[model samples]
Target: MKIGNLIRLVIFGLLLVFLIQPELFAGFFGLFTKNNQPAIYNQGSLLDITLNHLGIVAAATLASTIIAVGLAIVVTRPFGAEFLPLSRSLANIGQTFPPVAVLALAVPMLGFGTAPTLVALFLYGLLPIFENTLTGLTNLPPAVTDAAKGVGMSGWQRLIKVELPLALPVILAGVRLSVVISLATATIGSTVAARTLGEVIIAGLLSSNTAFVLQGGLIVGVLAVLIYDALSALERFLMKRTGQLGRA
Candidate 1:
């Protein structure tokens, strides 16, 4: 009912309509084309391309979340505390180099297509999730953890029932950042022969078709905004539910 929600709804609706029936906007895109060049990207369906793009990002983010969160959990444990620096360094590796550089390196070993792109995205997404999770776990209120211990909760039980739940909102914040970054970065995967919205943008670039470029960029941009907004809402909800809203 709020203005911001209304705007998000309208944008999401338009994105759906565009993906479902892109031709309806041909005239609009045509304004950017020259010499009667085709306006829509006909090489692949916009809906299919968008779905593929989301799939790749989702897969990579999921993998990144599992590994990063696991590493954070391990490093926070007493026995694993000494490994914190090493874990941090490992997570930092993916982001230490530009994504393009990672892709270039991956291509030789993984071959072209989705494998290399997934690797690049997975590695690039790790640092944020790992850092956020680590921060969240380490910053827990000592009294709360002490209370859990006093209640006869085993270390594992305390972590499962007390720590992770409280830390989840912070972890989700990192996931949100990683997901948004992956959405934009995944577009570049097309250069490695992966099926993605980047195909439209690359084609437009090669042909000097501004329309194609605009269409592709618009879709990706809108998707990033929408997903970011959605994840932020979820983060706020979790923070409130976990009594961390005031801190936020």
Candidate 2:
């Protein structure tokens, strides 16, 4: 294996160790803090919180992608072109409104737990995915689209087989960004009583435990970097399959 792959494995191994057995690093965590207490997030199992965190992010990203991509497809269609501005404005509203504000507003109606967090994350993730989808669809080569029509393909067939396949790289790019952002942002969900890694950091803040804060931050950071690299590899693979990478 390449050295880079080996390094990635080491990083992933350490992150897994931290998640599954954080106390193993207590001695190391003690070096940073004056207090001799073991640096650990003991309120709940780290693995469970991590799983919950990932699940919430995945669900929110999936929902946002569906809505954003569907809206993009609709507005880009000839019959729906007139709604582009309205669709753009509506999508922008999510990004325009602060996530914290959305949480504050949503919690009143949705009431605590994961519901409000889902709404906040879904809204927070919409703009990038929607904009990327719009860009991908609009920027398709005219000749390529013309060729699809020349082949006697129906509009639906052209979109499904040609346009969507060509646009997928850009769409996945948007999804990647959303997923990474959601991974970090989901930590905030714990404030509203949702199970997440943020709970570890928040608990540390409330009790002045630097160890808790560092561990929580480290876990989330590591997860983001690993996921980003993995997605980048996937994107490159897709590009390669589509002959987009070799041309350049």
Candidate 3:
């Protein structure tokens, strides 16, 4: 494997070890504490919290991807072109408001759990995916699209067989951005009673436990890095495959 890939693998392996047995690193982190107490966050299982955190992010990203991509596709179509401005504005609404504020507003309706977090994340993730999808679909080479139409392909056929395939890489790029941002943002979900890595950080903050804060931050950071690398690899693979198919 290439040196960079090998380094990522090693970092990911160590992240797994840290997540699985965080207590093992207590001694190391304890050195930074004032009293040098054990650097453990025992309020809940790190594994379970990590899993829940990932679940929330995945769910939100999936929902966002579906809705955003659908909107993008619709706006790019001849029949729906007039809706482009409206769609863009709607997608922009999410980032216009702070996620924490959204969470606060949603809590009254959703009653403080995964729902509010999901809503917030879904909204926050929308803009990038939508914009990228729009860019991908709208920026297609006119010649290629014309060729598809010349071959007697219907609009739908041209879209599915020509446009979408060519646009997959760019769409995936947006998805990668959304997912990585969501992964970090999901920690904030804990403030609204969602189970997430933020629980550890919050607990640490409440009791002035540096170890707890560090542990939580470490997990989130490592997880983000791992997922980012994985998604980047996926995007590269898709782009390569799309290129090969185009040549064929």
Best by the lDDT measure: 1
Per-residue alpha-carbon lDDT of model 2 for 35-69, expressed as tens digits? 56556777889899999999999999999999999
| Residue 225's lDDT in candidate 3 | 84
| Each model's lDDT | 0.96, 0.89, 0.90
Clashes per prediction?
A: 0, 0, 0
In terms of lDDT, model 3 sits at 0.90
TM-score for candidate 2, residues paired by index? 0.96
Better of 1 and 2 by TM-score: 1
Runs in model 2 lying further than 4 Å from the true structure: none
Weakest 10 consecutive residues of candidate 1 by summed lDDT: 35-44
- Candidate structures ordered by TM-score, highest first: 1, 2, 3
**Candidate order (lDDT):** 1, 3, 2
